[model samples]
Target: MKVFTQFTDEEVRKAQVSVLELLLINHPLDCPVCDRGGECPLQDQALAFGPGASRYEEAKRTYRKPLPLSPLVNLDRERCVLCARCTRFCDQISGDRFIELFDRGGAEQVGISAGQDFRSPFSGNTVQICPVGALTATTYRFAARPFDVATGDTICPHCGDNLDVNDAWACDKGRFAFSFVDQPTRLTTPLLRDHGLEPASFDETLAAVATWCRGGRAAVLAGGRLSNEDAYALSKLARTGLRTNDIDARPFPCDPSALPAERAQATGGMAVTYRDVELAKLIVVVGLDAEQEVPILHLRIRKAARQGARIVVIHPRRTRSYDVAEHV
Candidate 1:
């Protein structure tokens, strides 16, 4: 037969009911103080598709409970809606399997394995995916109100290419990491070591550099640490201003040809938008440690999977994506 498949409205409604059932039984019904509160799938899905009232006695299920297994993770049982997204996270996406549910029925709650602690590098994401404040970060516990923080959308300079830091708060590492530029350890004045060493003022530095390039051959071997403005300026000077293409800030050892073209940049470049992931029926990430490389994407992927998208992870080495993903 010809390949064909489609979910009927009734089938879709049933799937929605299944999701709602999970929320009714599992979610703590608490949204305040959670980082994922605004970004919460449970909150959005339940409000739209779940029962407005509880079927079971609310007191029967755990709520506002706490598990102190990892300093990075704080498990509040009362808030857990028992979605299993967190435990699935550690197992399918991360391959850590550090966290899981204990007991059965109403007694069930999220936790690290008995006498153990969740300790994966990406373990912190569990706190972000938790439907309620049930799971929280020790580092971000009770931090500023979400509304008080201003967000900036910029790709992380570190790690692999494409990541949209959705609601990157002023308190986020993206902002805090800028401290190095203002730190005393930073090389504010250009220094040239005897084996290429010496400190010089801005003007002196320019003159010295000009003298080197007077021979008609010089290159700016910059790093990804530079801001987009700085990289663009240097590139302009080398390419347009100087009629040379030697100014470069290649981040990794990959091929130079792989860089996005200027046209692509105008159309938002080789960047993978959140819309791409959302619309995808099945996404296969091959040979990449997405957890270590793009942590936030994993969170969004979790959200997408919850919404019925299939995620496949095929990595040579162990990875966190191995845990939460559907087709691991």
Candidate 2:
């Protein structure tokens, strides 16, 4: 078939519609409870281009969306615009087609075929792209609002060895993973093994910590997941304030003498934005399993495939994403 490289007058006419919005009139207005409320593209679009009033009736279509899509994400069909962004993501990016759209017409909606729990590792991205609150992250649900929360933009404190900060990244796990911090069995207060682990006064706790520091063999072990500033403060406290030679924070082995290789290679890596991935003529993965790790990336790669990118997979599970690619 001959390709239409440029928009023609007839094609433009066909694309026009009397509808004032890109979504169905039956969609819900649950932006408040939705995880994507602050950053949703659909909400933004509605403000600028939606009709003066909804054309839908209460009886036309109804469904309460959204249950968990996976451990990291949830799906609420009630708020779905049926954009299929989530479905395409699992099928094309995560290389796991655990979820799909079901039924047809106003009955049209998204869901897992067998009512099974979603188990994809990269399922978190589905919550990130859902134009509506249809998909949400389990870790972030009701944890805090984007506005109520404060973020300290700092560098990746890669194992807390006084690393340099070039670019700042948003905290997904820190903000969302509350189960670890708020577990019912968690020790919320300092437990004096002798004092019944009561909620001790701040001064009393400081004194105990100071006593622990008085000994010369005191060592510190830091995790890479710490923010750079927090790591630096810990390192400084151990080496300077405590005068201990046993200062350590890294939990895993590293070649820390050198810059973090993954970030260092970012400039040369396949650093394609969602839009760029959607527009690429060919998308090639270099040992990257987006579906297993980067669901948003996988979704955009799928979008590119839908738009005609020749998708090539250099990996195994990638055979799935590649199927969505033109030349798989």
Candidate 3:
């Protein structure tokens, strides 16, 4: 029952070399321009364990360059080593069978069905887990090499510290929809409507806003991006300072009384969690499309269904969870 993993033995070293060679038999040599060039696992393994030179001189297999699997993901068939990480992620984790290993033998590659697109909310994860540059994110296509980029640790704005919630996964919006921060049209300062829209100093803008508030009624309209403390302060300001009941934080109009009970259930010590969903006997969803709204929750609901939980979704239309849940 002895297991050897280190390449100390000559046979083990030779076996490792052979495996690397076979994996690189048809792997393209376009690492110089690849998005995963500097951080690729295959590149590091090839440099460490692969033979110094290749013996094959025949023409390499090719595919149409940079096939758009979706608006967020692109595929280069020739660069794929058939590791099946992307396919497995889709099948096992996201439950979105958008792409699969098509064809057979040497011609086998990852692809989607004709006229189909990778439309999953978790599709960006495949690019993150790819061993090679076969799968690349469209937003990051040739944007920067790994060595050229600087990264810093920051709290995820979507979900805070609940490990049982998303389980180390982020939806595509949280993962890739960050380009707007750097867009040219993004507002950096307050704009005053003096002669159309002109950038004004914070003091000037606040003074004008205060004058307007003093003149007439001001109803607080807070955006969803506000924190709990900010929301509380705004609520106080709207209730006491402005003496108005017309305050809403939601982007859409809804009855003020419609959500307080629901919010109390979530915040008043009785919260429905992912673990609860996984162990529940029955889950009744009302007016909520989990897959389109909260993808990680959708995955948890699917897991619960696989574990023999009955899921009943009451929505206006059928959702992606229809396969695993009963539609009402």
Give all TM-scores, in the order shown: 0.50, 0.51, 0.82
- Please write out the lDDT profile of model 1 over residues 1-328, one tens digit for every residue: 6533224466667777776786566455456756657766667777777766666665545444457767666777767767798888776655567788888976776776667877766665666666566777766677765667787656644443344445421112332344466678877678865677778788887777777775437666887556789888888877665556666565544323334332244654556676777677787766555555455566556556766778887655666566557775
Residues 220-282 of candidate 2: C-alpha lDDT, one tens digit per residue: 888757668998898898888888878665434433332344456666665555567778898
In order, candidate lDDTs are 0.63, 0.62, 0.81
Best by TM-score: 3
Q: 1 or 2: which has the higher lDDT? A: 1
Q: lDDT for model 2, on a 0 to 1 scale?
A: 0.62
Which digits, one per residue and each the tens of the lDDT, describe model 3 over residues 177-196?
65657889888899999779
Point out where model 1 deviates above 4 Å. 1-72, 76-83, 92-95, 104-108, 114-117, 150-163, 167-189, 194-200, 222-233, 239-328
Model 2 segments more than 4 A misplaced: 1-15, 18-59, 64-74, 104-107, 136-175, 178-189, 195-199, 202-215, 225-244, 251-328
Comparing candidate 1 with candidate 3, which one achieves the higher TM-score? 3
